[model samples]
Target: MTVRTLFDRCRAFQARMPLAGFFSHSTAAVLHGLSLPKALEGDSRVHVSVVAPTRAPRGEGVVGHRVDARPSVVLVADLQVANPVAAWCQTTA
Candidate 1:
């Protein structure tokens, strides 16, 4: 599937989620149009960062991070995605 298709799928996945969090990691990279490594290409898990007190959303295909500071974010196709810089930082750590 193409990036557009992946974004649509992410949007759909976000819609079904109850907790509020911005997409991070490879998911955010895709939203920001950043090229990803081959290993990440097959990662269907959605990466998200939630507020520290609230637990990260859990499920079969989701990777959640608990952060004390909420990172900046932007909406892509109506899905909340972490900003490129913050997402890049997240990916680095």
Candidate 2:
């Protein structure tokens, strides 16, 4: 019950993976658990596709990614739902 509650109350979860930088995109994915496939793993900077107003990539305790109230998914709780693009199952897989 504790574990479930812990999980339920949680939103985004990012480990301090000892990475070089905690820039914008990576920060969002790390804290939010959203995957950044197109990004290089070691860029030490964040790069999201959306151009947000008041978006700044630097902050204290945040090595790279900076999070704010935006339309995109900003937490782990967000992953349960699918994105706008339909994810098709590949028969080949």
Candidate 3:
């Protein structure tokens, strides 16, 4: 998906989440202004992660992850996004 489309979707998804979760993986990487491989850059899904005990979000166009530990989060363009280190680690997993 185009970055603009992904960002618009991200905002909509964030508004629907009941509890706190942060954008992670490729989604967060984009929020952090990092370059991604072309394949990942083109992906349409947004990666959203919540610490365990809070059920991960489910919906179309979203990839949800339940993490055992709370990842560091930061605000990016008014959206909650995983910190750079956390986002990078999530990508590797």
lDDT per prediction? 0.78, 0.30, 0.82
Q: What is the C-alpha RMSD of each candidate to the true structure, in Å?
A: 1.9, 10.9, 1.6
Query: What digit string (tens of lDDT, one per residue) describes model 3 on residues 1-93?
Result: 566777898898877864778898999987787777666767668999888888888888888888898777899888989999888766666
Worst 10-residue stretch by lDDT in candidate 2?
A: 84-93
How does model 2 score by TM-score? 0.26
- In model 1, the clashing pairs are none
lDDT for each residue of candidate 1 in 20-73, tens digit (9 for 90 to 100): 688888889877888777777787777878888988877777788888888787
1 or 3, which is superior by lDDT?
Answer: 3
Q: State TM-scores per candidate.
A: 0.82, 0.26, 0.87
Encode model 2's per-residue lDDT on 1-93: one tens digit a residue. Answer: 132332332222234222222223333334344443553334333233222343433333333232333332322443321122211110011
TM accuracy, model 3: 0.87
- Poorly placed runs, candidate 3 (over 4 Å): 37-39
Best by TM-score: 3
Q: Give me the candidate number with maximum lDDT.
A: 3
By descending lDDT, how would the candidates be arranged? 3, 1, 2
